[model samples]
Target chain A: MNTTQTPCRELQVLSCRPGTEPTLVDLVLSPPGWTCRAGQFVMIRPLDWGSELVWPRPFSVCDVSDAGLRIFFQVVGRGTRKLAGLQPGQKVAVWGPLGRWFRIDENRPNLILAGGVGIAPFVMLARREKTDNLSMLFGHRLDLCHYPYAEIADRIESEAMRQTTAADIAAFETVLSGRIKTLSGIGQVLACGPEPMLKVVRRYCLMHGTEGQISLENRMACGVGACLGCVGRTVTGEYVQSCVHGPVFDVRDIDLGE
Target chain B: MDQTVQLGPLTLKNPVITASGTFGYGLEFMRYGDLTALGAICLKGISLAPREGNPTPRIAETPCGMLNAIGLQNVGVKKFLAEKLPYIPPGTTLIANLYAQTPEDFGELAAIFAAQERVAALEVNISCPNVREGGVQFGQDPAMAARVTSAVKKRAGSKPVMVKLSPNVTDVTVIARAAVDAGADMLSLINTLSGMSVDIRTRRSRLANIVGGLSGPAVKPVALRMVHQVTRAVQVPVIGMGGITSAEDVLEFILVGAHAVQVGTFNFMRPDNAFRLVEEVRTLAESLGISSWDEYRGTLRA
Candidate 1:
């Protein structure tokens, strides 16, 4: 397929879970474009009609292999609601390894904080991708509230076994204190999930002088830059759209209030 | 195929624009698509002073749609001209989408943006949710929509003032007629439907904000219906949008009386969808031997 000319391809739905429904679909792309980095996402469409659905729902690239990509998304709205209804082997459309990736510095001990499905990308980043000393702090509504943490644990275990070093990737499930203040430890933290959680994590990072990058979950249309729907204010007071400039950003740089 | 369209004094090479709130200042999406190729790019919604906007979970997805509660986050009028104006594409029509809590605020900001020579047109964004005015606000009410339209038009003077309407209204045509009566040069319909999603398992609102404006393909039929109705009710040209992903969709809107079409969420679906829409409209026109796509604009049958 032509790199720039060909439309981004949709792959078969390997699975679709209707509860907290995370619809996982694979997308096969050509050339260098297929490698969706950590904290990156792809725009997915459930059907073929061009503009039937007003917006393209963005899904976190939960996992990807050389064969294709995976998106972990909840069936929250009209788009996802339709997606959640799809059975396995059904076609799901997708576009791009869109937006910038989670910036990782292997030099520092990595601290991972995931809120619900926001943990999707971190799973990809943590597995096989070596970190100096990886410690993960995951917060959900409750222990079995939502998201695919068991799958994350499996990847971490498998990756650790391959490395021949059982450096425990510490995991936790703490109740939402209405604020993301419970997390601690590690020099650099990567957090994703709901807005409130990311905000608290960001504030904690700023106060403690710890470096952090947060994966922003904003409604996007193109998953590209055509629509300026996902603008996020920066700490520097500049408006940067979350879709183009990032799905991930330095936690301190984002203005979470608006 | 020629993409340019004459909007008042401005001549655009294309009819597809980055609708307000969808494309921030033109400088934001320079890397994603051909910035020069667009007919116009409306910056994020601007107000008299900086607005804090709404709270988070600002966005939530629906079937073929998503809801947004951004609340028009922007650097007020003065800052926009000083910081963002210089960065827009030179020849492209630069429309500043204006929002205000009151009619006076609209007039003040319109006057300010009109003063800047760089701004080609003023897109009065009356569709914003008014936090202060006891919620019986402009844009939702036809009379208030007209009031704000007249205020902006009077301040804008000779500059074309396009009023963007909200789909949350009961009768969009009534509001459209009010805007036209208030001297609007054009009207853009269907700026997100107010909707919400819930996490049934948790029994909570899906978005941090209780409600958000919905946009995407799911809203297309509703948008098209509004465009059709508004075009019949008012004389001003209507710019139709909602879930525009292809050139054929552009033709469909034009046939339904949309003078132009704005590609919103489609931009997120494919970075190049805007350019593709422009190219497809041209190819579609040529294929039909229409000579000009404008001839087909607003030619829809009742």
Candidate 2:
């Protein structure tokens, strides 16, 4: 576990862009001290928000640069709704680059599967890895524009998106399994999505004996491990705190019972 | 302003202490600020053996608070003492919060910390609402609360025993009196209030445990009333906590008769919040012409 973090700092919002899709947003804040690995995330909340929403929302760091700390997210609920209303120069409290990072198995062909807003972190992953061997399989219920495809578009070798209808899902699975079948014995599966989608990905990886890692979006009050509010069970029956042990876990390490 | 406050026989440099279960062994927040600056740091609840806690979806955010049914997932006492305890910085006061299924188990758990020189005090958690066994059961019954207090007090041996009281009870003062009568050196009042949240879409409970203890600013008023009741009902020094986010909240607890205050849910909003409050309280108090905890504690006119 990476205990290193940029302690909470009130950074001014540099820019807030409504995504191509209405609910989606690209929020950038100014902070030079923070850096993040592909899979790591930050806990953030608008400083003005008091008990209106006490707990800060956790978002995967989409990209970080001299420009600002970028986080692409969907305004799913009250927190994001409030976040969407932000204007430039408004400050939000943030602490991050917390949790473990993704370990790219350099030897293996990595297949990344992202669902809807789940594509946020992979933008950083795809940008950093720069591996021609990587491919992205994106699935979402909405149109292709709803997902932040452009941020990650030029980074990977190939990309595909499928609507979440049953037939479309089955087709997506066929294409994913076919790609894994082509790898023979040397492939890695990395995914972040709705639970049901990740469950399918985990099953595919487990069945094919390919190494897999899935980033879990567990609800956490405190981003630090103190709250114990974001625990997930492992294959061995041990409840691991997602905040500390991982927001990302190996498919075999966690048990998604049938 | 004088920041020091006496919590029973244990003297503290300041009134702000991070509550148990929220502070995570006291080492997790090292990135935020100095641990030695706070009065003390109470750790996660420890039992005789390791606990797996509840199932998934253990937390849900509410309007002003959150519901958590962590069920006390913790590394066991032996493991906590072995791996977790040694790493905490020296000069930082460490309070071992104990949780058990029975009075006998409570006494044995207390004895483990009582003999360790690193442990500064024992905070007995007789009130945890999420677990299926032990904690809340012992808390709801005065006899059981008294038994647990006496059992821990017998083995505590000069180390202060602060029995943390639950807010789920009909009359919190009844349990407060029972624990104080049984030999609690101090009392920390108002653990989370038991509550539930539902997802109307699925027609299912938000938390996997269905019900969980509620904490955050939402419970502040309830905590205030109970702390006032308990502080007046018992002679022991009282440490008050529940949804405390700022130095103002810390003073609110003190003004209502708390010897000291603990920062709980606010630690979630900002990792360095409790540390910030340690300084914020000084600034706030100095501006208000308050020089010491003695001048303000329990001075609530109502």
Candidate 3:
């Protein structure tokens, strides 16, 4: 994309997050000049957001179709809270299709494990290529109805659970373990969610030696690697800026320890 | 609007240089705008060896600004000149911001840049903790600040040395004068203020380092006061910064006697902000009936 020409402009969103727990913001922007991929993201701020909210919030690009550029996220801070209140035709300052992307090997069995809104980037992944090898297992505290769970339902073999308790979480982990065992050594595991959830998935991937990629969500200021704010530690004991290197990192490259 | 401004040995195409650390290697913002368009690009601080820097959660958002303790992480000077320097376009004027553990190391780093003709000037960040003196900040002490300044000046050759002053002191002008008296060609103030924040629920400091440097719009008033003080204290050219958000802020620095202004934290708000500000500064200068920077600079009434 000629990103220089594509400065942050006021794009009209067809809609904001449809439910309270999970959001799907669709900005009325097309991606002709965009080379947007599944794991890449953007830093967005609604125009009306006062100076009180200093920095733009980063989100994984869900899907950028003719309908608009979509991002899935839940309100976690002042920035997201203000983003949640955005309505149709409201102008938003969107600067992205940024960071590294997930290069899905369409031929391999892909077991997608998502926690809460961590399932966001996978929607675009599911949309781009539909194959018999792909499936998603989503676990959230909020019910599946509160999420855009049904959007990719028909495209892949999907399973979701609402886990609010220890027992519920343990039961979900059993299901997660079973899925990794089922995928065996052949499948590539792509997981996203809170860090603890990623830690669990990372363990499963390691135990079964399943090759995959995991997208990270860190507190970020600049998405362009300049601010050096959002760095994730590598197993090699180096800090790489997730904003530039990979919000989407290889399962082997990162060290997400407990 | 004449865009050119001279600071000792170097002449900038414009007066809107991107602050060090904020602008990266200038390679990161290639898509945002042309690099040569700005007055100059000050790269992140470079040390003798690659610094691993601080732990994660290095930044936190404050009222109109933010706090960051990046630990001055950067590639060593050799790699910067060998790998990073060649990639930056030839026409673009580059300023190398140098940091070190001791005065001797500071001189060595200075000579590294001084030998490179591509590096137009040197910005010495005296705000760093001196390891030899048990980690006291060089900028916090006038004698220590002068020692570092003289070390850099002795090795910097004909390259203009701009000592960046810290605001976390009793009086910034004291250090500013010490630097000028020790042969600093130009001065830039104020570096981020020392501050901290906390998360009530977690009972943890917002930044991992506990204390971080605060920048952005929140520190403008304090920055202005310090710049005005330092300009009156020393004869060298003054480059002012702090919470500079718009063309008005750029001119405010000039009005307060800054020869030029460096746009820092505001660059994080928008990647193209510094590029866009060049024209905004010219137009704003014209609208205010300011002809040349020479006539308009330091014209603030008491």
Candidate number with greatest lDDT = 2
A212: Cα error in model 1, Å: 5.0
Chain B of candidate 2 versus the native chain B: what TM-score? 0.99
Q: TM-score (chain A) of candidate 1? A: 0.78
Better of 1 and 2 by lDDT: 2
Show what share of the native A-B interface contacts model 3 retains. 0.60
Q: Predictions ranked by lDDT, top down?
A: 2, 3, 1
lDDT of 3 by residue, A148-174 (tens): 678877688898888999999999998
Share of reference contacts found in each model: 0.44, 0.83, 0.60
Instruction: Put down candidate 1 lDDT per residue, B1-302, tens digits, no spaces.
Output: 56567766656677788777776676756655567778888778887788666655566656676677766666777787788788776776788888887888889988888788878888888776524441226778888888888989989967899999888778888888888998999998778777878888999887666777777888888999889888889887788888777777788888898888887776655555676677778888889877565787777665
Summarize candidate 1's per-residue lDDT along A67-126 as a digit string, tens digits: 446566654556666766667676656666778887777765666777655667876776
Model 3 misplaced stretches (Cα beyond 4 Å):
A1-9, A17-35, B128-136
For candidate 2, the per-residue lDDT at A101 reads 67
Query: Model 2 reaches what TM-score against the true structure?
Result: 0.96
| Candidate 2 residue spans exceeding 4 A from truth | A1-6
lDDT of 1: 0.70
Candidate 1, residue B6: the lDDT equals: 72
